[model samples]
Target: MSFTDELSTVADPLWDAIEGHPMVERLGAGTLSTDPFEYWVRQDYVYLVDYARVFAYGAGTAPDVARMGTFAELLDSTINTEMDLHRAYAAEFGISEAELEATEASPTTRAYTDFLVRTAATGSFGDLVAVLLPCMWGFNETAERLRERGKPDDERYAEWIDTYAGAEFTELTTWCKELMDDVARDASDAERERYRDLFYESGRYEYRFWDAAWRQEGWEL
Candidate 1:
C-alpha cells in the first residue's frame, strides 16, 4: 500500500477521536469563541516547547553520528521557528517568552511531554515519530481546516489560525509525514500498532490538555 493509504488506515481511530471531540468540532466549524481558542493556543505554546526538547534529545541520542547531526539540525530549526511563532502570538497577548517559559505546564501537558521524551530516549526512531506525528501532523491538518472554514474576524484568532496553517507549518508537517512514512516501511506490524497507539493517545491527551488550560484560573488572552 502507499504511504498515504497506510497513514489513513492507522489514523482512523485518531480521526474518530478528534471528530468526537467537542472542542475540535467547534474549532473546525469556526464557532469557537476567541477566548477558548486563545486559551488553547497559550497552552499549546507551552506544550510545544517541551515537545521540541524531546525531539532535540532524540536527535542527540541517535545511534549514528551523521544521523544525529541531521536530527539535531532539524530539531534546532523546528525549535527556533516555533519559538519565533510563539513570540509573535505572545506579543498580541501581552505575554513574554520569559513568562511563558516560567509558567508550569498543566499536568496533562507535562505528562504527555515527559512521555514523548522518555519514548524518544529509549525507543526506536519509528517509535519517536509515532509519538510526535500526531501533534505535528494532526495539528497542521486541523489548523488548515480551521483556516479554510474561516478564522474568527478577531485579530488574535486570525493570528493563531494563521500561525499553524501558514506555509512554514505546511512544510514542517510535510517533512514529518515523509519521515514517518519512510520509517514505517520497514516496521513490523506490532511496531506499527505501537506507533499508531502513540499517535492516538497523544492526540487524546492534546484535547485534555486544552480543556484543562481553558479551565485554569485567569487564563485570559
Candidate 2:
C-alpha cells in the first residue's frame, strides 16, 4: 500500500469519529439547527482564511515550480472559489462579507487553524500533506456520504452539502491525495511515522471542530 493509504488504515478510528459525528448526522437528516450552523459559518469563514495561507506556505515550501504552481492554484481556488460559497451562504444568513471577514475565531477555530499554520511553518513540505489531507479529503468523504443519504430540504443547507459533494471538490481531494502519496513515497521510515502522528493529531482537531460547531462552543466569559 502507498504511504497515505497506510496512514489512512492506521488513522481509521479518528477519521471515523469525524465522519460519524453528531453534527454531521444532524446535517444529513435536515434536523440541524440554524444557530449552530450559523456559528459554524462564522467560525469557518475565518477558518478558511487561514486555511488558504497554508496553501501559500505549501507554494513557498515546494521543491519545484510545478508544485508551487499547484499550491498557487489551490490557494486561489480557496480564496476565490470556496470563500465565494461562504459569502453566498452568509448572505442567506443576512450577514455581509464585512461581518464574515471580521469574525473572531472561537477557541476551537483558533486552535484548529493555529495547529495547521504551525505545522506548515515548522515542518517539511511533506508534513503539510498529513496536516491538510484530512481537511480536503475528510470533508469530501463526509459530505459524499451525506449526499448519498441526503437530507436538507433547505436550499441553504443543501447548497452546503452539494458543494462538497460536487465534482470540483472531489477533484480537489484527489489532487491532495496524490500530493500526499508523493510525499509519503519519498519519506524516510522515521518521517513517515511522524507524518502518521501528524495525521492523527490534525484529525483529532477535525472531530472536535464539528463538536464545537454543534455546541457553538466558546470560552466561558
> In model 2, what are the clashing residue pairs, if there are any?
none
- lDDT of each residue in 62-112, candidate 1, tens digit only: 557875776677678666876677677676778787876776666666787
User: For candidate 1, what is the TM-score?
Assistant: 0.81
Return the TM-score for each candidate structure: 0.81, 0.96
Model 2 residue runs over 4 Å out of place are none
For candidate 2, report its TM-score: 0.96
Off by over 4 Å in 1: 10-38, 61-70, 217-221
RMSD values, in order shown: 3.7, 1.2
Native-to-model Cα distance after best TM-score fit, residue 43 in candidate 2, in Å: 0.4
Query: What does the lDDT come to for candidate 1?
Result: 0.70
